[model samples]
Target: MADDLGDEWWESQPAAAGSPGVLAANANSSDALCGPSKTWIWTELNQRASSLQKPSGDEEGRDTEMMQQDTAPVPEPSQETKQPMECFLTQAKETKEETRKTKKWKKKKISEILAKSEPKPGTPGDLQQLIKDHYSGSRSVIELEELNLPDSCFLKANDLTHSLSSYLKEICPKWVKLRKTHSEKKSVLMLIMCSSAVRALELIRSLTAFKGDAKVMKLFAKHIKVREQVKFLENRVIHLGVGTPGRIKELVKQDGLNLNPLKFLVFDWNWRDQKLRRMMDIPEIRKEVFELLDMGVFSLCKSESLKLGLF
Candidate 1:
């Protein structure tokens, strides 16, 4: 019975050489047999792997594009959005207009070039310029000519004495003689204008009472603020004011120094410093002098009441 079964199985397994199962089995047995047949399977595997990598490459390309879009420079801000720039341009235009307007200023006529020395009776500035020009010359010295100063309480001295007090005595001989009669402290009846506070102090030192207390106060713009000066003048009974023209002008403007009752206005006329500069020689101080003159000094002087002396 076993021999009959084995024979039947062998008979059932056909010996056909063209069968697909037998060919596949034989191809896997040897490289020579399987070389070309295995090509299809390897080609299929490579195609599947390449397809998978293609999706990743596409995803990477998209990521790079998004990064480029984010990192790209944005356009400049619009005109409406640049408010500060617009304001700056507007300011520049306005400034240019102002400069153009200022360029149209007329040339100032030389005050001395004209035959007549007198200034036109117009604005205060014109009068101020005239006064400045008159004193600007190197030989611009106020002489003791009676024609120049008539019926005034002022006196012209040749030169300052050894000391300031000596000089005062020489100028105000009658005042010194009669001052003993007055019991009240002599308020500042005289304003001594000088170039600097140091000079003012030097002049004040000369005003010291030979036999009594030297009641002298300084009034210069140097080292002192304007408000503080006003306060000092307001509170104290200053007998003599010795200061620069600038501070003197400030005082008169602020009404700190009363020029109404002022009798003697002494100026350091001939006393030139090492630079040969008198009070009028300096520009700032000269301008200040003009300002003081404008502030009722010249008006008072026109009445010939307030005396102007060349110290």
Candidate 2:
């Protein structure tokens, strides 16, 4: 029965040579049957896939060229071109340093100039010599004028008088006691010293002790009585002259007078002369005289004393 069924199936299958189904199956299987055809199909598929996947050698080469162009080297600046800039910077630095140094030097010089400058005549020692000479009876009126004091001398002279007067008032009792008990010769010497001191004091007073705005003439008038006495005493000594020391000694013994009066008298006489006046009027001389008077009478009087001993 199986053999009979097999025989029936075989009869139902069509023959391969003339059947359309058989032809269609053969065409579908042609790639597997032909090696060259299969190889050609694979090569064409790979070519198309590679074209879609990545860049070719030509495109890669173009990309490489662009990268190289982007990274091109820039030239460095030449030393010759940079030299001028460097030099200019150096020169500017040096110029600033030099300017700083110059300013420092100028400041130093100015400080030195000011430091070395002289003090004004109104300061100490201004009238030291004038006071000394006036008291010691050594300086003549001409010599006083020649001294060329500053205006400050007069101001200081006034100060000296005020100071001395205060001192005298404080010691007046002692002076009076000394006057009464002392030998005539000793008394005379003391008196001379005292009188000279007082005259110096008076000179200073005359200069500084006045009220404001008075005329020179009126001022002179105010002190006229004492001034005349001073003048008279000065004239007496001048008339006696230095050669008449004996006469001067006798006169001192008799009158308790001192050489101070003569000295001041001489100074005044010389000072008041037209010639001395003209000289004193000169700005330079006037300044000098003022300075001399400001040094204080006591200081100048001491100097005159030394000169007197020498003479």
Candidate 3:
């Protein structure tokens, strides 16, 4: 009966909400045995604490699944999330291409403007500039009034009459008689400097206006070698030498074209080449011209025998 009462007392006691796994005792342990009863109650409390400390099987499985979910790897970004960045990169590339195109168009526009602003040859202003550029390397460009050149040597007013026949009549009216004498001496009496073979041929054809003109010889480096022409001039009585400065120099070096009776130095001065450059404006042609001047051609000018005429 006492044990039963003690048991009933323990069962009737309520646990406090504030403290879990805690035990409380009533003051009614006076009827119970001290040692064993206290031991039994403490043993019961320890068993309850142990039972509460361990979880049920279902609870353990749920906790394990939650931990696995937390530790799982984070997945890579989806295509949807990356779309904005890819679109940004594509737009940046297109913008750069447009910028490059704009710069190229600007460069082309600037080049066209420069080409239009630059001067072309044949105008009066361009002719003045051409003359200036031609004699830029010369020591002096003043008119040679001290020379007192003969009227028959050069055309008056520094004009070639704008045509070959007119030019012939103006400066070389007695060319037929003069060439006859030069033919007997087997010497070149005149050197007509042209820009190219085409111009040289044109002038040669124009001399046929009289239908019985003197013999003419081509001294250019087209369809023939310079050395071969030098060999031919030795046997031929060439009265007029027509060619570019380059081929004429080869003849002078080989002592083929005799300059003894040579008195007139005619230049195709008004003609501009493809690049709008005159004969003296070109470096190689100008250098060859200076070389020809050094080869006893200018000695005639010093002796008042040679005269310059623009044709």
Per-candidate count of clashing residue pairs (backbone under 3 Å): 3, 30, 0
**lDDT by residue for model 3 (120-142), tens:** 32333333344355546663546
Top-TM-score candidate index: 3
Instruction: Provide the lowest-lDDT 10-residue window in model 2.
Output: 186-195
Model 3 scores worst on lDDT over the 10 consecutive residues at 119-128
| Pairwise TM-score winner, candidates 2 and 3 | 3
The CA lDDT of each predicted structure is 0.62, 0.38, 0.67
lDDT of 3 at 301: 65
lDDT of 2 by residue, 157-261 (tens): 222223433433332324334333433221121111111222334434443322122111111212334344334453432211211122233434345344332
- What residue pairs clash in candidate 3, if any at all? none
TM-score of each: 0.47, 0.23, 0.52
Ranking 2 against 3 by lDDT, winner? 3
C-alpha root-mean-square deviation, each candidate: 17.6, 18.5, 9.3
What would the per-residue lDDT of candidate 1 be over residues 24-90, giving only the tens digit for each residue?
5445544753666677754654565566546677788999999999999999977765578889999
**Mind sharing the TM-score for model 3?**
0.52
